[model samples]
Target: MNNLNYGIIGNCQSAALISEKGSIDWCCLPIFDSASVFAKLLDDKKGGSLSFKLTDDYRISQEYLWQTNILSTTYDNGVDAFQVIDFMPRYQQKDGSYYTPPDIIRFIRLLKGKPQFSIQYDPRLEYGSSKVFTTIEEEYIYSQTKDGKYDSLFLYSDLNYEDIVNQKTITLTSNAYLLVSYHEKLSQQSIDRCYLKFQRTKTYWMDWSEKTTSYPIYQNEIIRSALTLKVLSYEKSGAVLAAATTSLPETIGEVRNWDYRFCWIRDASMVIKVIADLGHPLSARKFLQFVIDTIPDKDEKIQIMYGINGERDLTESFLDHLDGYKNSKPVRIGNAAYIQKQNDIYGILMEVIYRQFVEFETTLENREELWTIIKGITKIVEEH
Candidate 1:
């Protein structure tokens, strides 16, 4: 059975879902709404993935590192064992700004005797629509689309590039690192730099978790849930995504699938409220700012949803090539529901706005703008 047993890792700008066996089945690069770099979760055949191939005797186990979004998957076969630590770098830079890159790092460590594995580094560019051409360079392995719309990715690693591309078995003697990036790096990629990033990212998440107000009951669950909401938040635009994927059927053999990588006013407003209640005011405030930025004109008609960067138009379309999840057909991208008018959104936004006003003080300019927004919502509500 194809199960949704995947742990997520992200730096807020983009996220990827790695299966329990350490396969990155779904990922979109550079941004949440970009065409997928790895998407085996949608189509088993056409959609590509990056995974570690282990022998039948190997026993696999997966878990998130405590208080952090980093995922650890271990493979053991009695005599030999190793772990694959997956994480996307996200930490605060020296200038008090966040350094959240669209990069996924896989750190491989030998736990016991010489463990063996093979790297399956296939990547389908532009939602599996284009043929990808990979070239190994001294600095990194670059893969780009050969035809159609232009897209690319880079893989930097200490492992043998020929062995990785040819699927040759590699005996793990020591720790190694694989870094996947959407953009080419100017600085030299090395194992020591990877370790530093991992440590910084780990510290970032732990500190973030520590800041979230914990209840005596369900404290662990609350932290996990809060962490999930945090990762869904886009740092650049302050938009919170409804979900990271598109075209996954709600039920078997149904067409209810829709792209949720965008932000819905109703959904985001509610999320802001929940986040505020959890004592994460920054996220809540940022989302409010996103709302203001999205609808600059007071009289403008509100969209049901908008892109992560506050894009108004969300034109829905199909990726007919993809087989969809579990043979479900007509895989879709974008969301047509953006055009649909929801009457309750005004009230929802009002609630969030009211909560923000009550709990926090704002500058006079912001307060005036928010009051103007309130008046606008009131007028719209009364009109309809």
Candidate 2:
């Protein structure tokens, strides 16, 4: 049985699910709403995954690094031991902007003796409907659909490329790194650069966690939940996702499944309220900006949800090629609830806006904008 015993690693731009055994079973690159590059969680056969196959005697365990989104999976067999550290690059740049690319780094470091494993780098582009062809180059391994919407991925690794592609068992003598990216990197690529990125990302997460309000009781739980909420927020648009995945049935072999990758206005506003109370006003401010940007015109009918990038018209559809999670069938993407007229959304949105006005000080112009939005919401509420 396929269980949800997976660790999530994301850069706020996109996220991936790593199994307890160190396999990237589900991931969508570049952004949360993009077509999946790895979807083995949905279909074990046609869906693809990047995994490390170890011997039977090895013991495996998965856990997130303390105070960071970095996930570490360690494998041990008494004589040999190693850890695969997985994370997506997310950090601040020199100009105060962020450097969050659509990339996942897997750092394999040897802990003791010589640990041997095989790499399975299978990527099914376009929901496994497109025919993908993988080619090797000196700097990176490229996988793309031979025919279709021009989807591709680049994998830069310090390990042997041939062995990785051939799935041959190799002994780990020292540290190795694999960088999977949605776009081609312009800068020079090396193991040292990979390690630097890992450190920077670790620092970013730690700093973010430190900024959250901690309680005397359940401090760890609060920080952990805050980190999870932070990861689900879209950095570019400040839209909070209800969930990252789509089409996992509520019950096995049932059709009660829907896509949840989009941002619901009511849901995001409520989350912002909690986050603001936790001393993270930055997220709340960003979400307010998202609300403003989404409803530029006061007459525009607000949707229940919108794309992370503020895209409307989120027409839902199904991918027939891939099997549903656990044979539930009817894998779906996008969402169809945007057309629904949920009157209570304005109330939730107004609550957050009201909190922002009372809790934080802002510029006169910004305050005026909020006041105007408040009037707009009041008018809409009266109309409904």
Please report, in order, the local distance difference test score of every candidate based on alpha carbons.
0.90, 0.90
Residue-pair clash count for candidate 2: 0
Query: What does candidate 1's lDDT look like per residue over 332-380, in tens digits?
Result: 9888888888988888788888877888766677777888889888888
Model 2, runs deviating above 4 Å: none
lDDT of 1: 0.90
List the candidate 1 regions with Cα displacement exceeding 4 Å.
Answer: none
- Span of 10 residues, lowest total lDDT, candidate 1: 360-369
Model 1 residue 317 CA deviation in Å: 0.9
Query: Mind giving the per-residue lDDT tens digits that candidate 2 earns over 12-85?
Result: 99999998899999999889989999999899998899999988999998888988899999999999999999
Q: For this target, which candidate reaches the highest TM-score against the unseen true structure? A: 1
The per-candidate count of clashes, in order, stands at 0, 0
